[model samples]
Target: MQREPYRLVHSVSSKFREMNHKIGLFGGIFQYAWNNRKVVKNEDDETIFVLVVKRYTTKHEPWNYIRPYEILRKCEK
Candidate 1:
């Protein structure tokens, strides 16, 4: 079976949004925790998207921080 590709639905952080703008529409990586994901479904019982937290490790930043994200597959019709 084939799997669909992921697309960014929303970003809870301004920093993340800025990063996405810099990356443009063509190609770039958006890091997130696979273990921290929450699945979101539509009324039709199909999975519309997944809600996940941003995954990052900073050498200079503090120990605790969280950023939420919504992602889904951009299906081609």
Candidate 2:
């Protein structure tokens, strides 16, 4: 038997134009195309991958001056 590697990905609205945005599709078993979305990039390497979100939220509401990471961490717990 063979096994395939697994990866984790997360995004709200895609910043790249080539990637189509599937709004409100952030749970599981569904994906849309994305491009050039990585912390580090190599020249001539334009690869795309699937993105999965552990948790998601809408920023429509105002926060009490708290950072986003802090809020995400609290939500994870």
Candidate 3:
């Protein structure tokens, strides 16, 4: 049987995006789309695969943070 992808959620600061861009860690060039929630990218000519689950913006709230989830891996049933 097919497995389900792992999911994780956490609250993060808004500066995460700026830091990523400055460091060029997760801000990789688009390589291709894997599925609905997964994508492959190239960072410095190296393959980088990422699976994003969900994203939420708290701009209008009393916080300067965002909640994003990632699917790290899949497990067999």
Candidate 4:
């Protein structure tokens, strides 16, 4: 079956929009380690940003990290 192309709506940061325009979906996966550090990269094997996941009594807080897809969907609202 054919799939629709992914498009980023408005409201996303210019950085993400620029990246998405330059490269197709910043292709990469979130990598986790025992240290609670997450690394983000792009399809060209480049590091985008590094995040630290902190555990709290209520929820886990991720710092310096934004899900690639979430950025796209955010414009929907």
Candidate 5:
């Protein structure tokens, strides 16, 4: 049987919404894949892309942090 790609939706705050937005999209999809990863092996293991949306905000100039984990938690919300 053919496997299916996962779909995930994510929302980010204005303060942390400036660069690497596509990374956020991939993170969501990866999160879904992590939740439903298969045990069996296959000839090809590839990722599929889906749709994405970004809501405009008045806030700009996002901040940066040393700890990536903290930043990821903030974005995962």
Candidate 6:
């Protein structure tokens, strides 16, 4: 039993401040339409990073949209 490598946490805003990147989810969900914005991959699949989803918050709650704001890092078209 040895399978633990998939980290991607970023919640910046409203004094939350949380950044952790070690992506590895196999292509990282490519893109299936999430809304706010999304695109993560770091297991050889490329796509660098990007996952902003913080539309005005009040410190937890309000449907909680997976709070993510680690934008920047996608220059390899």
Candidates' C-alpha lDDT: 0.30, 0.30, 0.28, 0.37, 0.41, 0.28
Q: Give candidate 2's TM-score.
A: 0.17
**Any runs in candidate 3 off by more than 4 Å, and if so which?**
1-11, 25-77
lDDT of 2 at 8: 29
TM-scores of all predicted structures: 0.18, 0.17, 0.17, 0.17, 0.29, 0.15
Candidate 2 residue pairs that clash: 9-52
Model 4 spans with C-alpha error above 4 angstroms? 1-12, 25-77
Q: What's the lDDT for residue 20 in model 3?
A: 40
TM-score of predicted structure 5? 0.29
- Stretches > 4 Å off in candidate 6: 1-17, 21-30, 34-71, 75-77
Model 4 whole-model lDDT (C-alpha atoms)? 0.37
Whose lDDT is greatest here? Answer: 5
Which residue pairs in candidate 3 have backbone atoms (N, alpha carbon, C) closer than 3 angstroms, thus clashing? none
> What local lDDT does model 3 show for residue 22?
31
Candidates' RMSD to native? 16.1, 17.7, 15.4, 13.2, 18.6, 14.9
lDDT of 2 by residue, 1-77 (tens): 37644432333333321122222233111233333344555522223212322222242222222244234424643
Report the Cα lDDT for candidate 6. Answer: 0.28
Error of 3 at 3 (Å): 40
lDDT of 4 by residue, 3-77 (tens): 754555554567666656432322222233323444434322123232212322124323333465447535653
Colliding pairs, model 4: none
Positional deviation of residue 62's Cα in model 4 after best superposition, in angstroms? 31
Q: Which residue runs does candidate 5 get wrong by more than 4 Å?
A: 1-18, 41-77
